[model samples]
Target: MLGARAWLGRVLLLPRAGEETRMAQSPAPIPCQPTTCSSSMGHKDWMDKCVCLLTAFSEHMRRVPVALPEMVHAFSAQQQTLKQIVICGDRQAKDTKALVRCVHSVYIPNKVLILADGDPLSFLSCQLPFLSTLRRLEDQATAYVCENQACSMPITDPCELRKLLHP
Candidate 1:
């Protein structure tokens, strides 16, 4: 999603080690050399240089330049406003199917929706890092909406789910 101007700036600002070495020797500009071209280099040398460049670029783009805690803090900050919905039930139950269908019909931006048929506790703990505690499903089909570490009352009906989502 980089703009053309930003991309051009990166291309221009990229440090050229060969250019730097040549510049330090003399003030006069040197003619372009074919030996500097990748096509003119040996296949093994070209491949090695390509790998080095890719590794350096990827390292530069990583969010954590130093430590794991910094990366976790950055990720948490990015997800602070995220809203989550968990639909829990037996997978083959009619009520669970109805709830899934109802949920799919609605669209909410930045909302993380999970359909859990197995152990709800394990699923919630793994997917939702901000939730300290999760309530167990009481019915054959149920749903919960959580935001800012707070959860709404468990809903058992699909119609109630639609209302809660739209409201």
Candidate 2:
């Protein structure tokens, strides 16, 4: 069996309908750059594609077991304080993804995101009192930024959400 990265290289080189003929005529490159798949490509059977990908990955993992890699970030924060962002709203709301991305960009160290549908805060807040007030503002997707149980006012706009995470 090939190593995970090499196997992935070959799998990625699989040609699409139109490219099949051209790809077969020439050899694939020795090195392949990683690529991201967009959901907008109009492939209707994404779930099936996901299943196939997962199955292949699982088979590879069963044989190799584990792969260790060390990563270093020079600009990473040295602080230990946890910055938690709690978002409560419709999970499928388009803006929800943007809100999550905003949280990721600002905090590099010790960050946690708690995503919930509606207000499940009554029970959860008992343990983390800071989240007691987390809820969707105006029935729209809302974000709350908290540190050490102290939280900011609900943010309804993407720009406002990013500012809260940065400041």
Candidate 3:
């Protein structure tokens, strides 16, 4: 990542051939168009902010930018419940990635994915305590769709998970 950052003012990805990627003149922090955290906050703080923004933007449908940013805070507290999907399996396995891809395809904005690969990182369960109890059902990749921390039955089929998320 640092290697990429080193080339900051030197290169940019253009949408079309021979197009100008940036302005001739700009303020400090020359390349601010795309940034992870442009403030004094450290990496973890920036990551948490990114996750929060992702959660907020996921709520808007095909379009919402036409409205003011205030729409995000306008929602009632009760309606802001987060939906967590915990996947317990070998995260490196091809099948596990496929399941995660399917989850990413869903339009539901409040959803978040947590991968709990078991023992070596069992301490992870301390952060998300439910991971301590949930395991691979039937010895296969399993997904638990939980809302407000209460989950529906363990899901082993991608289609079943889709139905639960969308319909």
Point to the candidate with the largest lDDT.
Answer: 3
Q: What pairs collide in candidate 1? A: none
Model 3 segments beyond 4 Å from truth? 1-78, 120-123
Off by over 4 Å in 1: 1-80, 118-138
Against the reference, the lDDT scores of all candidates come to 0.51, 0.50, 0.55
Off by over 4 Å in 2: 1-79, 119-132
Q: Positional deviation of 140 in candidate 3, in angstroms?
A: 0.9
Candidate 3 lDDT (Cα, 0 to 1): 0.55
Steric clash pairs (candidate 2): none
What are the per-residue Cα lDDT tens digits for candidate 3 across 45-156? 4334434544554544225443223233323222455577888889887767767887998987555688889764576676555677888887788888876448889888
Tens digit per residue, CA lDDT, model 2, 1-167: 22222333223534334544443433321111112111112222542344444444444444433210000110121113456678876667787877877777774454668776645445555545445557788778789876644777889888998866766
Q: How accurate is candidate 1 locally (lDDT)?
A: 0.51
65: Cα error in model 1, Å: 24
Could you give the candidate ranking by TM-score, starting with the highest? Answer: 3, 2, 1
Best by TM-score: 3
RMSD of each: 18.6, 13.7, 10.3
